[model samples]
Target: MNPVSQSRQSAIFGKRKEPHTVIIARGDQIRHFTVRPWIAAVAGSALAAVAVGYLLATSYLVLRDDLIGATVARQARMQQAYEDRISSLRAQVDRITSRQLLDQQMMEEKVGELISRQQELAARQAKIGPLLDSAADLKTSSDETIPTPAPRPDVRAGLDATTHSTLAGFLPDLRAGSANLSAADNADRLFVSINQSLRSIEADQMDRLKSMTEKAYRTADAISNALEGAGLSIAKGYGTSSVGGPLVPLDQSMQFDAVVDELDEALTALDTVKEKARQLPISNPAPGKQVSSTFGVRKDPLLGTPALHAGMDFRATTGSSVRASGAGTVVTAGWNGGYGRMVEIDHGKGLTTRYAHMSKILVAVGDKIEAGDIVGRVGSTGRSTGPHLHYEVRRDGKPLNPLTFIKAGKAIAGLI
Candidate 1:
């Protein structure tokens, strides 16, 4: 081969395989090192690889720190949101509990008030029971029938149905802290209904008391009229008694108290009349025995001539029982001028009764006696021509018509 061709080939190949030279000189001493082409190439490649690795590592570290910070911030925000939600739920629960407590307290207060009213009504009833019974007696004795009052409402039973049911339905919810405004409103309505019922009962009681008072007044007035017709005054008998007190007006504000006071006064008047009638000579000495002669200006049985006779004569057999006409104390029991084996009784209110012409005297002076008590035996004795009883009535030592008393007694027989 030609030398020129070979040199051209070597030149191409040598350019690629060229070696690198490194030299170091300090002062006059100098050092040099030769590097082969392959060695230099390898060293350059290694340096480039190291530089790329360092850049990659720096970028990874910076990006990793940013990612960690972002993740931590997101987690903190989520935790704050959850905490806010929990706080709101807790506040709602507290409000509901507070409302329930308020409702429960109100219910308790209302119940207490209702119980107080019930107790007051019961006390009033206790006081009025006897008064009503007395009024009923007066009604029975009266000639004219009195109107009966309506039956009273049972306040306790009605209140129990209304108040108890409401409480029972709402109490559990309140205890559980679940009651709301609607439940409270319902309870209020129930309490109002109960109060209304109590008011109605109170009104009924007042009406009944008033009616009883009126009835008592009527009865007392009737008794007074009857006594007046019989020539007797209740006041005359009661006024002389040792009983007196200051008169104080009853308070009108307390309705029940005022009505009760009126009833008491009327009953007192009636009692006075009854006592007067009992003491007076108002009953027949001998029941079922016909009177042979009437009182006042009758002919004497012994003389058979017109004369002033101040007594009635009962046609009865000898030894028949002779009863006192009224309750009294015996004043005379022995024979007087023309009255043999006689008995005279002194009743109160200046009234007296006498039983004369008796076969036997059964009572003595100062002996207490009552109407229908056997005081003598019927017989023809003083100023009599046959077996009979001489009965007489006197007021303040003056003779009164015995028939008048007998009629009055018959009129009031069932009353006093």
Candidate 2:
């Protein structure tokens, strides 16, 4: 059969169609068959695949950018939180550091004043040495001129190599009854340690102040010892003796006040500081609140008649906790006349505080109560009106207005 006829028969009989092809011819009769349809389709699919791959790359880059932006935002928020906390802590540290600086400054002023005073004392002590020596020579010693014949052999009684220094006056008997203060060596109040610290600092005022105080004490002691060795009392005398002391004339005798003037001033300043520390308020005091009724006067709440109130009436709730105003041992507890179920605390500064009209007592007579400790519940009790705690602050067997101390304490509390 012809090739064209066979091809037509295959088409007619439903045989698979042959692939379409194209041919290209060049000069000299060289020809090439075209690519098959399936091959063309595969090339088209590869081109499409390349295009999709390009889209996918672009999408990935966009997604990566978004992820980076999100991460950056999150980091920024976290950093802000940490920075805020750091700033707050820094502020607190600054405040505490300031307080320490103030305390340091105060201590430094005191120490400087003390050192100045000590120098004055030392000067007077210096003057007294020569004065006392001269006075002793004038009063107790007589100048004797030894008759000098040219080295008489009989006169030389045992005097060979060492010549005895001229005997002056006997040392004064100044050591009598004396109570040496252990703190006499201390020239200034010890500075409290620096409470807050920074990461790095060249110098802190607190440390400097503390050092100065220590130096003042040691220097004073050394000076005192030197004066003592020079045959003169640091003062006219340290302690009193039963024997009268004007053995020499008044004009020549060393003045007692001048030698220890610095010491006296220093002592006065120290006392001022000590008193301030003592008056410092403790934590929540029962007597700190405003007084509804004072201890002594006014008409009775129930009877509406003038009556003597044994203790101050502090108006508070029934369950409000009553605190001890200072650290002390409880000396009295339980019921007493007009002070029902009261607690009395004896703080060693010759001061005592009493809390009365308690609903419940938590401390006994021998118990040690620190300042701001809950000693009992406040309530109305024997010979009293409604629920109110009776509080009293006493000093040296006399009642004082607790308001003044309480107000001062409240002022301090506000600082904290």
Candidate 3:
């Protein structure tokens, strides 16, 4: 109804609003301000936007600092993990290296042991070689001296080709120290083969030693038998003088040494028996001489009567040489009662020989003489009907058959 009231109503309801007025009083001063509704609204909104922007900026700064810290911590953790992994890998490498060194050392020790065994075998061969040579020599001598139906195989041939080849192949590899861990299994097999070859050589050497011992015993027995057949007693023991030493026992652990000792004993026995056979008078006194009268009961040429003859009469010239039958010392070298111009030789071991009816005596009493040594000259003297020499063999002052000695000498001529 009124104009002021109408204008207020229009301003409240109109699309284009009116401005408002503000009054302020301070002491005696008074101020009035006008503000539009749209302007106030825009100013409030701007203030709200500025407050939001400040809050957002503060939040962003604080969160950025926290994110930087978290990133640095994560990087540190990753670095620590990598360091641990490196340490573990290093430990594994060290373990592998140690294992390889241990394997190499063990391989070296095994190879050294094999080398020592090879050296021992070589020493054994050195010892056996001499024995084999000696045995071969003995066998050869026996073959030449005695007659046999068939020739025997050589004992030295027992050393086979396998033994030599195995030794030759394995020794160089061992000496060079060329074995490695990669070839450990192969080295073991080769060592086994070499050991087998050494054993074979040892077995062959043992067989040869046994054979030599047996042969020596057999030879000694044969010599004893021959001597005994000729009415000669062999002494049980010989070499009583200049043969004294300590009685050292043999080493039982070394079988080869014991066997060699046994073989040497057998050879010594053979030598002793051979020496005894040589001492006996077993040779012809006058070689190529015709025997006119034999030993035992026969007709005497001087008396032409049945008598006992104690010697053999050899038909020879007046100046024929008469030699000693065996090695001895001359006991009588002068004229005797029945045997004129005689020479009596005293061989050791209760044996003696007599050369009777000699023209001249060349050997004197107590003169040393050997078999086939000229002692006198033959002649028909002192109860001899013609120029003939009488030869007699006696044992312990008892007469024996001279033909027995002569026959025995022929049988063992090659052996002596």
- Screening candidate 3 with a backbone cut-off below 3 angstroms (N, C-alpha, C), the clashing residue pairs are none
Which digits, one per residue and each the tens of the lDDT, describe model 2 over residues 53-145? 999999988799898999999999999999999999999999977865554455445445434444544554464344333223122222211
Where is model 3 poorest over a 10-residue stretch in terms of lDDT? 146-155
RMSD of 3: 11.4
Single out the weakest 10-residue window by summed lDDT for candidate 2.
163-172
lDDT of 1 at 160: 26
The predictions' CA RMSDs to the true structure, in order, are 8.3, 39.8, 11.4
Question: Judged by lDDT, which candidate is best?
Answer: 1
Order the candidates by lDDT, highest first.
1, 3, 2
Superposed Cα deviation of residue 201, candidate 1 (Å): 2.5
* Model 3 local distance difference test score: 0.73
* Tens digit of per-residue lDDT, candidate 3, span 1-416: 99999988887887566688899999999999999898899999999999999999989897988889899999999999999999999999999778655545554554465555556556656665665554454666443231111211122222332332343354455534544433444445555655565566556656766777887777666666676787876764533457668987755227777887777677677667666666678888888999988999987766879998999988888898998877889999888978988999998977899999898999899998888799989886677778898999998899999998888777766555
**Of models 2 and 3, which has the larger lDDT?**
3
Please give, for residues 1-416, the per-residue lDDT of candidate 1 as tens digits.
89999988898977665566899999999999999987878999999999999999998897988889889999989999999999999999999888777776677677777777777776677776676666567555444232233333233322322453446453344324435436667677666766776778777666766776676666566666776798976673333468669987654337677777777777777777777778878788998999888977866656779898888889999999999888999999988767777999999878888899998998899999988899989987776688999888998888888888888788788777
Better of 1 and 2 by TM-score: 1
Per-prediction TM-score: 0.69, 0.34, 0.59
- For model 2, the superposed segments whose C-alpha errors exceed 4 Å read 1-284, 287-290, 308-311, 411-416
TM-score of 3: 0.59
